[model samples]
Target: MSNEQPPSEQPPPDTASDRLLADMLGLFNRYERETAAARASQGDTNPYDLAPYEDVHGVTNEYEAARDSDDPRALDQFLDNLADGFHLEDVRALRMATAAVQAAMGRIALAARERGMSPDRIAAETGYTASRITQFIREEKQRRAAGDQ
Candidate 1:
């Protein structure tokens, strides 16, 4: 059976998604202008002026796609390329992840000490190689030491 789709019941919602989509479209449309401006910076006098709409979705899509591929090197490259234009929330997320990893390692070391276990033994029990455990311990120790100075 054929059914005609009803028109929207109300006007479009003016939410963040709509704003971000509009910005992405604006940025996509500005590619040629950006390229000309970049070229002009290299000394072409008559080049187009770039409107410079920051595309959050473009960066996020690239970042998520790289991260989903399970390759840290690719993710690292994506981060490096993205850092200059990334939104503040992305920076906060990165900072949070760094802190969480550091805190987890600190907890493991503290728990190992409280249990009277040699870190190497703890590492073996936990499936990390002794060298990795040592490295983690030393990193936290060094950070603490530097902070004390």
Candidate 2:
């Protein structure tokens, strides 16, 4: 019997396309490793910088103006415009802005509660869940208690 292996058992020869794909995969793996290393070196610090203050301020102003109008269409339009203007780097700034707005809403809800508004009524008016409203109220009460101590 011949010593040659059967065709089905032989390995396929590498083509130029296969080499290119291998090279691309290697580069991608290297890039991912480097990114992970960099992030690890930062030790809980954010790697990306916040967006420019002017841009954040402008967006905040636009949001407030739209919200003040009390028109659903205006708010939708504002959101669409904000989405259109968003870039990858704006993530942190957007998060900060969102936190600020949430804090403001919490304060307003607490004030409304002080004025005898129930959590259910606040939730219905603000489109937030009643549980979330209650949570806000609890947090406010905790804050006041801490201040009194």
Candidate 3:
């Protein structure tokens, strides 16, 4: 008798093994997707890429020179250049308001001194040097005198 079986009498499919294989494939695909997302979240990790260092407008010669220089002041100048180039109106307004507040404080100090508050007492109360307090009072008096003329 022949040992071969007829094509119509095939063995049953291994359903358990097929399900396990399908599950493994799904897990592998999920792992690949997660890995790709992690890399994307990390952004460009290459140190050789200068794209991040370049300004949005363009790479200026001043920035390049500052970056290449050994002087510490060059970095300060570079920062100043960047700040001057990108003028935030809100920051400018805040700086102006700060100046106005300082002037007002100086005037108030002068008024306090005019009300018989000693320079030493004013300095101790305001956390300023006695000489600085005296200077502020003198300046205020001079300003008043100038206005009276």
Give lDDT: candidate 2, residue 130: 92
Assess every candidate by TM-score. 0.29, 0.39, 0.36
Question: How many collisions per candidate?
Answer: 0, 0, 0
Which candidate ranks first by lDDT, i.e. highest?
A: 2
Question: Relative to the true structure, how large is the alpha-carbon lDDT of every model?
Answer: 0.69, 0.76, 0.72
Model 3 reaches what TM-score against the true structure? 0.36
- TM-score winner between 1 and 3, please give it: 3
Give the runs in model 1 whose Cα sits over 4 Å from its true position.
Answer: 1-103
Please report how far candidate 3 places residue 104 from its true position, in Å.
2.5
Lowest lDDT block of 10, candidate 2: 44-53
Candidate 1 accuracy as TM-score? 0.29
lDDT of 3 by residue, 19-128 (tens): 78767987998987777677667873322233323332243555667888999799788777566645467456657876896787669789898899999999987778
Ranking by TM-score: 2, 3, 1
Ranked by lDDT from best down, the candidates are 2, 3, 1
Note the residue pairs that clash in candidate 3: none
Error of 2 at 77 (Å): 12
Residue-level lDDT tens digits of model 2 in 14-81: 99887787679879989877876788697623223333334555566668899989687999998886
Candidate 1 per-residue lDDT, tens place, 18-133, comes to: 87886787798699778887987898533553211244445556666989887769988776766655578767776787688667886577567567888779787666777777
